[model samples]
Target: MNNRTGCEDPYLNYVISRRPFGWNFTDPPVFLPFDFEKVDPFYWVSLMETNWKVAFYAAAVYIFVIFGLQNYMKSRPPFELRKLLFIWNLSLGIFSVIGFVRYVPGFLFVLNQPNGFYKSICVKDGMDVPTGFWTLLFAFSKFWELGDTILIVLRKRRLVLIQYYHHVVTMIVVWIVGPLVEPIARWYTVLNFFVHSLMYPYFSLRAIGIRVPVFIANLITFLQLSQMIIGFTVNMTSLYHQQIGNDCVRYPISIQAFSLVYGSFIFLFGKLFYDSVIKSGRRRTEKKLL
Candidate 1:
């Protein structure tokens, strides 16, 4: 029960290996005993790895399109595409739910395996999970998610700097990590999918004129800020592990990049939560007292 790497199982074979510079990586057993190849093929994965530039170019175009469309819509009445919005948000919610269900367990199972949390986060692996197929899917999903911004523009909602910043930075991070098969960073993807599973559905219900509880809206923002805080902590731990020469396989430079991004996210999400929830709620209370 070994592959080319001579480990005991396919999981260990792909993840645990000797790297240059005297570093080593080891992984736990697969939660489900099946051949990774047996998993369904994702067609666009190869193209993503081979023609990485396409992601960059597409990201550039996304920025241009966001600005252009927003400007074009400025003079016109906002189209309340209620039905379309409902469908779009619901579909994305379902997609995020599926991603969360499929991938989070796989990663959590990895964490539960030997070597503890730090090793699980720091150890780099090859495309262990079917060309890193699900991970790649999550990365590509970011592109598909640009539709969220477009919808906002069409609706004449103000595009906050953090919104576009998150989209662009996320695409770049995923593009870099997806090809590298950086399993550690996929934690970000898992958390995002979980959040979106709830967030998108809430948006869909609102679009359809359903009354969602105000607390639900505040909870979503809190969860987003919490995600950033936890993520930043994990990256910091990874950085610390790498610094001590734990023999864990990691891309040092990439870890640095991720840490910086997570730091930024913490500030942005915190600010957003404060403005939209705390300050707004306080203002409402003041008005009620008056």
Candidate 2:
């Protein structure tokens, strides 16, 4: 790491140098039983590494349950679990917001260093800090998010290919790559938290019968597409660095896998945006003329 003072900011300097692996908050306001400062992130890392197979098991169960439930619900009235949906989306939105807050500062701090952009994408740091704690939670949350498919199935909503594929692939990838603690993993975590913060809250509003503006819905899809584009770009850049023998850009296989996924997302989300926004708008216009 470069020897510059961390912008005269004590917190930033502490985050950069100390890289402490525990919560920064104290008990007076946010009271918890254990010592927040004493928590070890590596313990969680080891735990995740050992239990990575659980993601596959969960995915298998998830596939079986979603299809089975869809079949079972075919002859029944759709359940309107509006309250539960509201709660689920709201909880995830709040979690994502907190994650985004925790992650962005460290990410920005690293990005401002010398060759910061490259280092941010290449150097694996911050895995032993509070950020890592959130990253682990984010990975684990994928299993919880599989419940989304259940909601769709129960509601008799059409679960598109991208929906389940995205969930299962993401669950597997995050579980496998999360333990590696690659620098690029921060990029994935931060971008995902940022997107989900907006996404789940939007779902919350709709779940409770709020009529959100059409443009806002379109904007969310656009943002999702943009996120995929950025992710693809990041992976490709990392691959380029690795090709040129940049020692910091570790984990070539992981990068390639991520690149493939994001590349596919660009197509899937783009088609969704065009079909829902552009094509729908044209149809509405033609109807008005008719």
Compose the digit string of candidate 2's lDDT tens values, residues 55-174: 899999999999999999989999999999999999999999988887787778678768888977887543334565677788889988998889999999998988898899899888
Prediction 2 TM-score vs. true: 0.86
Roughly what TM-score does model 1 have, to 2 decimal places? 0.82
lDDT of 1 by residue, 125-202 (tens): 322443244565687788888888888999999899898888888887777655555546666777888899999999
Q: Candidate 1 — which residues are off by over 4 angstroms?
A: 1-46, 124-131, 288-290
**Which residues of candidate 2, in runs, are more than 4 Å off?**
1-38, 125-128, 288-290
The candidate maximizing lDDT is 2
At residue 23, candidate 2 shows an lDDT of 22
Candidate 1 residue-wise lDDT at 213: 84
CA lDDT of every candidate: 0.73, 0.78
